[model samples]
Every structure is written in structure tokens, then in C-alpha cells.
Target: MPDPTPETSAGRSLLLVLHDVAPHTWPDYQPFVEAVDALGNIPITWLVVPDFHKRDSLAFAPGLRSMLDRRLQRGDELVLHGYYHADDSPPPRSVRDYFMRRIYTHEGEFYSLDQGVALERLHAGITLFQRFDWPLAGFVAPAWLMSEGTRQALRSLPLKYTSDPQYLYQLPQFTPISAPGLVCSARSAWRRGLSRLACELQAARLSQAPVIRLGLHPVDMRHGFTRRYWMCTLQQLLAQGRTPMTKSAWLSTRQAG
Candidate 1:
């Protein structure tokens, strides 16, 4: 594959995404959002779950709605993450499937969903987003895991884009924009160590890429070490000439140019 690195600062960008945003997770985001705001004017792309884990729905959270409205006004983009954000599929047929879907991530709502089910969830999420009058440009499957059926279902929508850890896909058309994501894991001590080291190395490796993606979760924000690492990483990226923007804003610029 050809490198998507650019030669000048004009084409460089840093896409900051906050994942697993729901009513219950909103509180954890406050401090992190403030910290990023203090750094500079950075627009966040929030992946909002309509009904997180099938337990809590956004319909009951007026405070979260208001806060999200404010975020939109501040240039942040709201994206439909998933309906339930949990894997309720039939048990995996293989051990590999079990580990990848159940063990590696229990939040793979769209991971194994068929086209019909994927469409149902996407529409359900869209309806909920419409209820709040939130504008959506993309739908990121939970844990960045989208089954092939999910891919097909997304084609039926008018969304602008969707992204996994690797390539950012232009919606409907599916033209891929090569932008590898830098993510952190705050699950356990060993996981944190490995994830931090991986992110550090990936950042160094993608030093000149046209776009650098930073995927942050609510748990990551709550952790002291992960929080500091993200803040410091952003500072370094900006110092090196990357302008921070929401994922949608970045796409607009890239497409416009």
C-alpha cells in the first residue's frame, strides 16, 4: 500500500475521538473534555450509544442531551456508535470466534450481526439521534468491529463515513482514507503497558501521515497514566505541526482539497 503521508502542514491533522459516550458515561468525560479544551480549541468526535448495553437509554437523560447540544455548538460531532453496544448474538461456533467476539470484546454489537439486524440497529440508533436532533455523519461499530453484513447495511444509509482502527471509509461510496488510529487500553496493568507502548511506537511510525487518529474511551480518561499520556501525546503532535479537528471536519477538508 502507498503511504498517505503529506509533505506540508496544511494537509496534516489530528482526529480526536471519544468513544462509548452514553448517559452513564457522560460524567467521566467532563474532566477530560475540560483538559483538552484547556490545551486549545480541539473538536471532539463523540461516539454516542443510543441504549448502552441495553440497560440505559439516552431518552431518560435530559442533562446528557443538553450537554451534547452544547458540544455540537462548540464544533464537536455526534456519531451513532451502536444501538445496545453489547454482543447479543448466538453463541460463537468456533473458539477463535468466541475469543475474538466474546473474550477480546464483549461490546461487539455489530460484530456478527447479519444485514437485517445491522440495519435494524442502525435505524434504531438513527431514530434516537433524530429524537435529540443530533446530526450524524458516521456510524462506528462498537469496538470498531463491523461484520461484512454491517458493511452492507451501512451502504443503504446516506452517512458520510465510518472508521475502524485502520482506514476511514467514505460512506455510500466507501472510498477509503488511510488513517490508522492510536488507541489506549485501560483494562489491566499489562494491557495498559502494552497499549501505551504500541501507541507510542505507532505515533513515531506515522510521524508524517496526513492524518493521525486518537481514539479515547471514558475509562481511558478516568485513568491517571492514560490521561497524561494522551495529553502529552497531543501536545507533541501539535508541536510537530498537526492541527486537531473532529473526524467529520477532517473529512470535509480532505474532500474539499
Candidate 2:
């Protein structure tokens, strides 16, 4: 990892990570949660999935509710990750298939959603969070993949921020922390896993930006290779000169003038 590019700004440096806390991804979620808890008192913004993996409106799992409650009790706040953390498209062609073929194809294709659809999803997420009386903050695009229209839709919302690695500012646009290189690619799963972990650690070491966003998928947590990478990355972050922060902490440090 390289040193963070020195800056004159007085804002707080943050690790803006999102956990894909969805079903079938719990194997990874468990370890990720443990890693987060071990950080101890750091301000983390969680993009929660209260309805688990279902694409429709439903209640949360009893145990998941308890886990969320515990996290809130410890000071982490919620960001509406996504309704089901999947595209609202219909079956015969699953969301995962769509993501792998379209979003993950490396051609830079985007999943654009209109303002009306975006707002509907946001409202649904807000309703879930409000049930726990949780104050929803900003939005993080599912899988860090957003279309131009999605970006526009987010900017039109009342939310203060949205994250992406391509942008450098921290307002309607977000300060990005990109992995050193493309970690996951259309390759053998083993190779992709190894590369992704390597990129994450390399990114952690090389981050000179005031803030960096690390996105997680539940699938990564479940797989052994990715899980190993996850643990190693956490350890590396703990070892590095990095600090954890919530959206408010970062926002508070911005120049007021």
C-alpha cells in the first residue's frame, strides 16, 4: 500500500464500507460482523437489509432484528442498503445473473433507475429503518454499481451524500476509495477471489484520500478464499494508520465556509 496523498484539509479520514447483509450471504456476514465489533467504538455506517433477501416488503428475522438492535446499541447507524439488495426485475432471469452478466462484465455498463423508482425503493428502505426508530442517512449503490441516471436520481434526493470511487468530492458526489486495481474480474472464481483480496489490501495500504469506501458482498463472506481475504484485510486495516468514521463525522469535518 502507498501513503495517502497528503492534503491541507482538516476533515476526518473515514473507511466507508458497506456490508451486503442479505440472506445466503450470512456465512460471510457473521465474520464481517465480528470483525466490525472487534474494531470497538468506531463509527460505522451500515447499509442494512431488514427484510433479508426477499424482494418484497416483509418483517425482519427475529435474530437479525436482535443483531441490528445490538449494533445500534453500540452506535452504528443504518443506511438503506437496498430493498432486497437485488434488482427489482422479475424471475426466469435472476438478479444475480443480471449483475454478473451486465454489471460485472467490465464493459462499464450501468443499472440506471428513474427518480420515481429510486424514491420508491428509498422510501421502502426508510420505512424498514424507521420501524427500529433508526435515522437513515445516505445511500450506497448496491454493489457500488450505479448508472448515470441513478447518480442523478440520488443527487435529486434530500439525502446529503452518496458514495462512488470515481468521484472525489463529498457532497452530492462522494469521496471515493478505489481498490488499487480491478480485483474481481470475469475469471475463474479462485483467481478472482485471490485478486479481489489482494486489491483490497493493496487499496487499504495505498489509500491517501481523506476517505475510502470498501464494499462487501455476503457471498464473499461465505466463501473460504474471500473470507480469508476479508479477515486479512481487516487485520491490515487495524494495522494501518486508518480511522473509522460515520457519515456525520466525515460531514462535520468538511469546511463550513
Best by lDDT: 1
Tens-digit per-residue lDDT, 1-257, candidate 2: 23422354553254545465544455557766776677676666676764554642336355666666777777776676656666554322667756664666422222455666766766777677777677766676665566656666666666666555443234354444222222333145866656786676657565665555455555565566766665666556556666766655555555342
Q: What residue pairs are clashing in model 1?
A: none
Model 2 sits at a Cα RMSD from the real structure of: 5.8
Model 1, range 150-194, lDDT digits (tens) per residue?
A: 999999997889888988888886777788889988988788899
**Against the unseen true structure, what C-alpha lDDT does each candidate score?**
0.87, 0.57
Pick by TM-score: which candidate is best? 1
For model 2, the superposed segments whose C-alpha errors exceed 4 Å read 1-16, 50-58, 89-110, 147-149, 166-189, 193-201, 204-207, 255-257
Q: Would you give me the overall lDDT of model 2?
A: 0.57
What would the TM-scores of all predictions be?
0.94, 0.71
Model 1 stretches with alpha carbons more than 4 Å out: 1-10
Q: Look at candidate 2 and tell me the lDDT of residue 117.
A: 72
Clash pairs, model 2 backbone: 1-205, 2-206, 4-208, 5-208, 28-221
Model 1 error, position 26 (Å): 1.6
